[model samples]
Target: MKKAAFWIAALAVLGGLQLFVRDIVGAYNYQILVLVGINIILAVSLNLINGYTGQFSIGHAGFYAVGAYTCAGVVVYGQEAIRGATGFLPELGQNTVLLLVGLLCAAIAAGLAGLAVGIPSLRLRGDYLAIVTLGFGEIIRVLILNVEAVGGARGFSGIPQLSNFFWVYLGVVVTVVTVHNLVQSSYGRAFISIRDDEIAAEAMGVDTTRFKVLSFVVSSIFAGIAGGLFAHFTMYLHPNTFLFTTSFYLIIMIVVGGLGSIEGAITGAILVTVLLEVFREFGAFRLVNFAILLVLIMIYRPTGLLGSWTLVRAGRRPGRAA
Candidate 1:
C-alpha cells in the first residue's frame, strides 16, 4: 500500500508538471525535456543489462528500432479500424487508446527480438558480446534501410503526433521506479552477483544464463517503449536514426551517470541531453569539445558524478549504494 501511494503521488506530480510545461514552457525547452525523458528510459534500461548484469550490449539501438517501427506500423495501419470500432470516444480518448495499443505492440516485438538475440549472443562475453551486439544494431539499420514498406531509405512519415510531455515523463517515472525496485529484489541480487563475478555466481548456484536473459529481455522492453514514444513525438522514423552511434550515445549516458545506479542513469540522461544542446553552438567542433569534456569527466571523477549512489527514502541518509 505504501508503494502504491508513492507511485500515485509521483504520477500526480508528473501530471501537474505536464500541465505546466504544456501551458508555459517554450517549444524548444519543451522538446529538450521530452528528449531528456526518452533518454532516461533508454539509459536506465540499458543499465539493467550493462551495469547490473555485467553484460556488454551495444545493440540497444536494434531493439529501439524494432519498437519504433512496430509501433508506427500499428498506429498507421490500425488507427482507422480502431476509430471505426470506437467512434463514440472523443478524439483524445481514441488517440490514447491507439497509443496504448502501439506501445504494447512495440514492447512485445522488442521483447521477442531481445530474447532471440540474448539466447545465442549472450553466451559470449566481453568484447565478443559487444562486437555481436554492435553488428546486430548495424544489421537492424541496414535491414530497415532496404525495407520499402517502412519507406526504405526515405523514412517513415505521416505518423500522428500522439506523444506529449506527460506520457514521456510518465515513462521516465515508470522506468526509474521499476528498475530501482527490481534492483532491490532477489532477482536483482542475482543480477549483481553476475556483474561482480560470473563464474562465482555460477558456482553459487545462480542460473546466470536465465537471469542474464531475463535482464536483457526486460531492458529491451523498456527501450522499445522509449522508441515508441520517440516515434509518436517526432511523427517520423528513419533507419539512420537507430544507428550504432545512437547506441554509443546511450552508453555515454550510463557511463557518465555511473553504472549500477538508477539515479545515476537519470542524472546522466539530463546532463548529457542539456550539454549536447549547449554544445550545438560549436558547429564543426561540437564532437571535439564533447569528447574532451567526457575525457575530463573520466579523468577526474572516474566513477561518474553519482558513482553508484541511489535515491534514499525519507529519514535515511543520502548517497547510499544502490
Candidate 2:
C-alpha cells in the first residue's frame, strides 16, 4: 500500500510538472529536458551491465537502434490499424495507445536481441568482449543501412510525435527505480560479486554467466524503451543517430557519474547533456574540449563524482563509504 501510494503521488507530481513545463517552457528548453531524461534512462540501464555486473560492453547503441527501429516500424505500419480499432478515442488518446504498443514491441525486440548477443558474446571478458560488442553495434547499423524498408540510407521519418515530457521523464523514473531496486537485491549482490571477481563468484555457487546475461538483458530492455521514446518524440529516425560514438557517450555518462552509482548516472546524464548544449556553438572544437575534460576527470577523479556511493547506502549509513 505504501509503495502504491508513493507511485501515485509521484505520478501526480510529474503530471503537474508536465503541465507547468508545457505552459511556460520554451520549445528548445523543453526538447533539451526530454533529451536529458532519455539520456538518463540510457546511462542508468548501461550502468547495470558495465558498472555493476562488471561486463565490458560498448555496443549499447545496437540495442538502442533495435528498439528505435522496431518502434518506428510498428507505429508506421500499425497506426492506421490502431486508429481504426480505437475510433472512439480522441487524437491524443489514440496516439498514446499506439505509443504504448510501440514501446512494448520495442522492449520485446530489444530483449531478444540482447539475449541472442549476450549468450554467445558475454563469455569473453575485457577487451575481447568490448570488441565483440563493438562489432555487433556496427553490424546492426550496417544492416539497417541496407534495409530499404526503413528508408535505407535516407532515414525513417513521418513518425508520430507522441512522446512528451511526462512520458520521457516517467521512463527515467521507472528506469532509475527498477535499476536501484535490482542493484540492492540479492541478484545485484551476485552481479557485484561477478564484477569483483568472476572466479570467486563462480566458486561461491553464483552462476556468473546467467547473472551477466540477465543484467545485459535488463539493460537492453531499458535502452530499447528509451529508443522508442526517442523515435516518437523526434518523429524521425536515422541510422547515424545510433552510432558507435553514441555508445561511447553513454559510457562517458556512467564513468563520469561514477561506475556503480545511480545518482551518479543521473548526474552524469544531466551534466553531459548540458555540456553538449553549452559547447554546441564551438562546432568541431567541442569534441576536442570534451575529450580534454574527460581526460582531466579520469586523471583527477577516476572513481567519478559519487564513486559508487548509492542513495540507499547513504541513507542507511550516512558517513560510511559505499
Candidate 3:
C-alpha cells in the first residue's frame, strides 16, 4: 500500500514538474536543469559503489565517456543497421529510433566494461581500489584521444540533441528508484556489510568479493546511462568530460549529502548543482563562497548533512497520541 502511494505521488510530482517546465525553462535555464538531472543520476549511481558498497571507485567518468561515444556513434552510423533513417523518428527527428537504440547499447556496453573493471580491482579495498579506478579513468581518456574512429582529440560531434528535461529527469528517477530498491534488498545488505567491514563480512559468509563486484557493475551501468543522456542532450562527446574533475564532483556530492545515505545523495547533488550554477556568475568571488561552504560542511558536519542515520521514531500508531 505504501509503495503504491509512493509511486503515485512520484508520478504526480513528475507531472507537475512537466507542467511548469515552460514557465521556468529558457535556453540557458533548461540547460542547467538537464545537467542537474544528469548529475543527480550520476551521483546516485556512484553512491552504490562508493557509499553503499564501500568500494572507492574513481572511474565513473570512464563509463560515462564510453556511453557518450557509443550513443554518438550509433546515431551517426547505426541507423542503417537498426532501422532506416526515416524509421528512427517519425515525430521528433529523422533517427529517433537509432538514438534510443544507441542509448540502450551504450548503457549495456558500459555495464560490461564495469564488469571487466570490477573483476580485477574488486580484490583491493579503499585507497588501492581508488588508485586503480583513477588510473582506469585516465586510461580511458588516453584511449579516446587515440581512437581515430571517434575523431581522436578533436572529439566526436554531429550527435542529435535529443536530451532535454524529460529524458534527463527520467534517468534521474530510474536511477534513484533502482538504486533504492537494490540497497533495500539482500544484495544491498551484503554491500553495506562489505562497506562497514569487509573482513568481518567475509567471515560472516557474506561473499564480500561478489557484493563489491556487483556494486561496481551497477554503479557503472547507471553512470553510462547518464553519459548517454548527456551526450544526446549536448550533441557532443569528448574525453575531457570524463576526467578526474568529474569524479571529484561526484565524490563531493556523496560527501556533502552524508556518507552511506541515499537521502544524502539527492540532497548533495541538488545543493551542489544549484550552488555551482549560481557561483558561475560570481566570477572568482564564487570560488571563495564555494570553498567556504565546503570547509564549513567538513568542519561541522563531517558525517554529512544527512549522515548515516535518519531521524526516526519507534513504532507508533498513526494519528495517535505521541
RMSD of each: 2.5, 2.3, 4.8
Q: Model 1 residue 245 lDDT?
A: 87
State residue 5's C-alpha deviation in candidate 2, in Å.
Answer: 1.3
lDDT of each: 0.88, 0.89, 0.80
Q: Report the error of model 1 at residue 205, Å.
A: 0.4
The residue-level lDDT of candidate 2 at 159 comes to 90
Regarding TM-score, does 1 or 3 come out ahead? 1
Q: Predict model 1's lDDT versus the native.
A: 0.88
- For model 2 the local lDDT of residue 86 reads 90
Candidate 2 stretches greater than 4 Å from native? 281-284, 314-322
Q: After superposition, how far is residue 102 of candidate 3 from its true place, in Å?
A: 1.5
Per-candidate TM-score against the hidden true structure:
0.94, 0.95, 0.89
- lDDT for each residue of candidate 2 in 53-104, tens digit (9 for 90 to 100): 8888899999999999999999999989999999999998898899999999
Ranking by lDDT: 2, 1, 3
Which window of 10 residues has the lowest lDDT sum in candidate 3?
A: 313-322
- Cα error, residue 142 of model 2, in Å, equals 0.9
| Position 108, candidate 2: lDDT | 98
